[model samples]
Target: MGESFPMKSGDDSHSYSKNSLYQKLASDTVKEMIQESVIKYLDTDKVTSSMGSTTIALADFGCSIGPNTFLAVQNLIQPLQTKNLEFQVFFNDHFSNDFNTLLTSLPPERPYHAAAVGGSFYGRLFPRNSLTIAYSSQSLHWLSKPPQGVNNEAGIHGSGAPEPVARAYSAQFEADLGCFLDARAEEIVSGGLMFLVMPATPDGLTQTELSALFDFYGYSLMDLADKGVVEKSRIEEFNLPIHIPRLGEMREVIEKNGCFRIERMELTNPKSKVAGPLDAANVVTHMRSAMEGVFAAHFGASVADQMFDNVVPMTPRIADCFKALHHISNQLFVVLTRK
Candidate 1:
């Protein structure tokens, strides 16, 4: 599980400065898929009668400032014009998240009222069984804790070796998986929908793979830290707690809750034909807000910029990263319906 970082509410200057580059590169496809998945679970009869009066509260878990969120709302509302369900959308992240920018980006005329909810999803954020739908993309891999018995110096444990570290991560994964489901069970209403998209290995994530990715990210960040571009102390304070749950692992979590039923499970390898590596990096940057702490802790403050710079000038390298990702089937898309 990934550790939580303190988020900034409203328009904090530091928040904007830190996340600007990332927000620029949000992915339209990710937004579209989320919208589509949620729509699939709408109670049509209930929605039609509401006429924008019935409260249909939707949440974008770990939502950040970017076009992808707007696109998600666009896709959600377009299908609801006829239904006219009163929309109350909440953009949720840690307190350190930039809520102001997200609000500013939204149109004032939108029927929905948007608010930012701070804190980790491993805890409750809503009234029991109150939310109508919840959506999270590329975010679930972030766990709330490092594997047990491993200190922060180990760089998120299990990212270094295959023996005890892997076991530690797996144990932590099982515990966090339970926490996530329990929290969601309390929050999502009966018949509600939840959509999650994240990076995962075929047999679930192994410590070795996690270690490699963490090493890459940590090395990149340490490089910037060496340049005094970002504070090394801050890096130490932050924790990159991601646990890439396999399909079975996720199923185990959901089933244990016995509140949500799997509606769809897909493994997507989205390929884009952009000009070159820079364009590819742009896609990554857009996705960065969701990954801020994970990369930042390792690469320091300049990590995001460095990643963009590295990918921009090197097409082959960018292609290679993409290819490597695909080679391992690194992404997963899942949709669940409330029982």
Candidate 2:
């Protein structure tokens, strides 16, 4: 009786109603790396002096729920707080995000403010050179637009497979990267630092790999739909667009924008060493939220639920996916300093 997992919004933006599994894992890994990167990038003198006198303005773009946002800010501020910097924090996300949920996550004693700005990050959201630091995690690969030629109506399935699909998506990714960089350049202070972490393929942006992942899941969902266990209509209306940019491609965008220089880039894959298989499945489930809409659209709501149920039972396969992903490609961590 419940609506399908991938609910369609009034706006064209697709919603994967559940929290992303991959995002949770990636957040833990990236947040650690970002903490280290920011410490290294901040000016030593400012780092020392700001301990007492400076009012540091920090913003987390695409900050969702505020738990991770708070965690990231805490990581950045804890070290600097000892030096006397007065921290003023801001959380940014789509207008649709639950500001109440985000606010409840904040510590009662924390010195911060919240802004609910509903719009894509195609331009500056803050006054020119207002923020001292900016952070984004697991969010950048989501382009404001779908790939140039790929039609969402067609579904991400078909005979040719992922190659054609990824190519179309990558083109749009390149465009969005430019817009993101340009906007950040205008909003961040000259010496501010920006840390971005997202799912990226080291071999560069390949539509084939992306498409293959989608196909695998697409079939998996269809398998469930065939069972008559889930609704078909819900899946038909859902679609998700995700694009992972290559390091070189990102570099070009940053260079062209002339707002920031790369300070550090690292590729890492983190997997649970915990013994249970469900933990791994949960990780995959988290990752799926970002892509669930696509499956929902192609298979329909009934099929999507069935697919999720089916996948939930396959612990070994879940472990294999995580292990294979770890062995194959590393997630990216990048630190950029404003010019």
Which numbered prediction scores highest in TM-score against the true structure? Answer: 2
lDDT of each: 0.60, 0.62
lDDT of 1 by residue, 65-156 (tens): 64356556665666666664577888887776666677777876776888778777777888876677787765566667665455445453
| Residue-by-residue lDDT tens digits, candidate 2, 1-339 | 112222222222222324443455666776666777767778846533543336787888777664556667777677676665566787776665556666765777775554555445656788876778888886787667555555443344322435666567666777777888888888877768888887666664343234444545556655655766544444454444566666676766677777789898777664442243225555446545544554556565555656666656655654554454545444678899988
lDDT of 1: 0.60
RMSD (Å) of each candidate, 1 decimal: 5.4, 6.0
In candidate 2, position 332 carries an lDDT of: 75
Model 1 segments more than 4 A misplaced:
1-3, 6-27, 30-40, 46-53, 151-160, 204-213, 218-239, 272-321, 326-329
**Clashes per candidate, residues 3 or more apart or on different chains:** 22, 18
TM per candidate:
0.72, 0.76
Q: Once all C-alphas are superposed, what RMSD does model 1 give against the true structure?
A: 5.4
Candidate 2 lDDT at 159 equals 22
